[model samples]
Target: AYPILAKHNIKPDYVLALERHDLVYQCFEQDNQEFDKDILFIIASVAHKSVIDTLEKTKKSYILVHRPLPFSKALHMDDYGYLGSGLSVANMAYDLAIKLGHKNIILIGQDLAYDENGNSHPKEYLHTQESENDRKEGLFITAYGGNGKVETNQWWILFKESLEYSIDTNSVTTYNATEGGARIEGSIEKPFKELCENLLRENKPLFEKPQTLSEKEIQDKKDKIDECLKRVVILGRSYINECEILKSDLARCLENLNFENQDFNPLSQRIYQMKAKFEDEEFKNYFLDLIRSIFFHFEYKIAQNYTKNPTNIEEEYAKRKEYIEIHINWIDFIIPHIKLQIQSIEKGLS
Candidate 1:
């Protein structure tokens, strides 16, 4: 694929590679001969320390891309552009392309669904042992071209939805060059060869170097981050205190559990209201991703146990009390870490 791309002189301005994908390393190793010297590689951040170390050791000219999480936004916005919180790496790349002011973008190898051969990813990344039974049990969905069936899963369905949403909402003119996969709505389907031919004929600008922010812009962003950090710290402390109060109240309610006249509607409503505060976009944008996950997990557990009208009040109370204690302990465990993160951010900004 690289050799064919090089033969046609079809150089992309940048390649958005997710660090989680082994294909990123494979391309640099195997296709190094076909790579243009000017092509910039933008890699997404991975959680694994080994992968991070490997990426840092690479000699390739690249920038690490990060989602608009609190820390990344605070630090890397000036150097590396922020990719919005989209479900998949493909969606992140698309968002990054939009941010880079690319109006005419072509997507290649964005097969959101499995191929006809029952492979989840391309041949390069399929190192895992997959059984025929596993392949047979995979979900079937209509292919992007609407001709045949393609394999997909729930996560892929979510990714496809996210891709569709990104394309539909953005002003960019997107062309899908993938020959197979689930169809991404709002993108024009064209063969990769034909798209490249048209691009070569038109002498299109395939690459654009990202611009650095001005000093004033950088200072403004720092100021915004500082303000956000302060707000989040305050919110975190307040939430912990509130959770303590709720935990005590739940304990008292559990102590006086009445099976015949049991009514937890008010308690459930209160918990729902508390959970709704975390659902705010401002909170999501400002809080640390792990902290957000913790909060979300607590809310999910609470919803699962307490939200529904229970058939057996005493049995439900036992479960609810257990979860409530767990939630309280979890909050206690995380609040200090949240404070530490706030302090770190403050120190870094200073």
Candidate 2:
């Protein structure tokens, strides 16, 4: 795709590569394709270390876009950072485009669903063998050209939904120029050539100067980070205390063989309180991913048990005990990481 685009002298204003898509850079290098240096390469900050190393080795100019985490606020892009709510890099790229003030954005090669040949990504990119589970048909969505139905999995559906929401909620006009893949609602479908032809008359420069943070903004960001770190310390301590209390209650319940009458209300209330605190608007832009990561697994476990409807009383008792233990273990696992994060933030501040 890179070679074909290069052959046609098509130079995008920016190449929003997510994480391991550094493979795209390799393709360019191998082909000896020299693209416009001004083409901004926006990469996710949490990208794998290998991707970072590869980019550094290739000496490519790029900006690291950061996503909001539970312990940290979404950094301002003017400070060379970006925030995305979705997990996929495609969603992050879309966010970057909106942040760059692109009113009219055209998406190319964003095939959220597998192609007819069951190819998830372009051949040049790294290919992971699709598991039987992954290959299983789930939802059916209109193909890019509206020519046929394409099979999509849950994750791709999520990406499509996020993209659609972003498009609907933003003032930007989005167009799908991929000419293949799953259809993204709210984005008009247009051929690549036609979209280019329409834009050819525009005299505006393809790329804009990078937005940099003012001195005051930089100071404000630092203050925000410091405050966030302090809150994390408090939250971590509170969580540890709650976990200890829950563990004691669980132990007592097990001792008395009172599983049927056991009251989880107190534990539930504590967790609810924690969630409420975390969801505060002041912390909304912060490390939501971290909070979700710590809680989501446990929540899923509970949900899975409910779905299975455990019938045996003893089995139910064991499951409940296990759940409590898991929560305790998670708290133990997370506290050290939280302390470490706090330390890292403090060190950065100093």
Candidate 3:
């Protein structure tokens, strides 16, 4: 949208982004579009560092906002308002529209479903080749007009659910102008041309520059940020140490274990203790979300391929060992990313 609209001298007043994935930075590289300085980028504070890096390299102006979804516990930017819902960028845009004092909104191109050709996303924001493959499994679901179905997927269903929830709660009138695709509840269905005829105006409306913090407030925020950054840095290092402890305990138990008598109670208790570390209060405050996601990914794989009846106790032991190793590897995977988050925070504030 940025590249095509810019070519015709059409520009958006604001753009919203809430993705935390590291790969999201690549979207800016597509088409090599020089984003306009006049455009305000409403970036989530928890977004990947690479994303903010690209924004800076392009010299685009932006304001960092935070979502209250575990964000209040992780970072301190509460003054910008919690502007995320439904865990989708569309929801974030809706929230921003309401925050900016808009009482009416018209949705368009909000398909939330694959086209008849099986493409699940626009070319502008395709995250990866793997995602493209994941989106095309030849699926279908009920369409907008309720007379037929359209090709869709699990994610598209989820996106619609989020938007519907947002609309159901907000005190505003919504006109759904998407000519085709999934149905969003709580929205008044209308044709795009009909809605435009009633809503479109000949003159443009002026927008006020949003108020920002004063100099004293800015200094206070910086001081608070510096303090929080140092604390998170110190706390994040403990995860590595905890992983080492888990690895050592598992190694000692595995070496002397006896699988001869079909007795695995001792090992089971050890595994229970190993899982407890991941549930600690302090750790959950920072890295538990990442840890749990990786853990579940491994668990899901194990369950997907599990046999109803294993040949022997050795196979069960193997599964147990695999489970423990997943936790160890998950910790290893998240620590560096934690540092990357801190770097992102520093750069975002700078």
Residue lDDT tens for model 1, 1-350: 33345545777666555546544454444344335567666666643344345445554566666766665664435555566467776787788878768787888787767665666664434343232225445677778777887777777778888888888898988999998887777889899899877765655465565687899998897787677667767776776677667767766666676312244566656666766766776555655565866766766776676556657856666666665565556556566766676676667667
Best candidate, lDDT: 3
Residue 130 C-alpha lDDT in model 2: 46
lDDT tens readout by residue for model 2, 21-80: 445444334322366455555666666556556556656566776666533333433444
Q: Worst ten-residue run, lDDT, model 3? A: 124-133
- Reference-based TM-score of each model: 0.65, 0.69, 0.75
- Name the regions of candidate 1 deviating beyond 4 angstroms: 1-12, 19-36, 45-52, 70-81, 126-137, 205-288, 304-323, 329-350
Tens digit of lDDT per residue, candidate 3, span 243-315? 5666666565556654433344554465466457556665666566545676677667556445435577777
Query: What are the lDDT scores of the predictions, listed in order?
Result: 0.66, 0.65, 0.68
Better of 1 and 3 by lDDT: 3
Please count the clashing residue pairs in each candidate, in the order shown: 2, 7, 0
Relative to the true structure, candidate 3 has a C-alpha RMSD (angstroms) of 5.0
Q: Who is ahead in lDDT, 2 or 3?
A: 3
Among all candidates shown, the one with the greatest TM-score: 3
Candidate 3 wrongly placed segments (more than 4 Å): 20-38, 46-59, 120-134, 200-207, 210-216, 258-277, 298-350
lDDT of 1 at 46: 49
lDDT score, residue 81, model 2?
Answer: 47
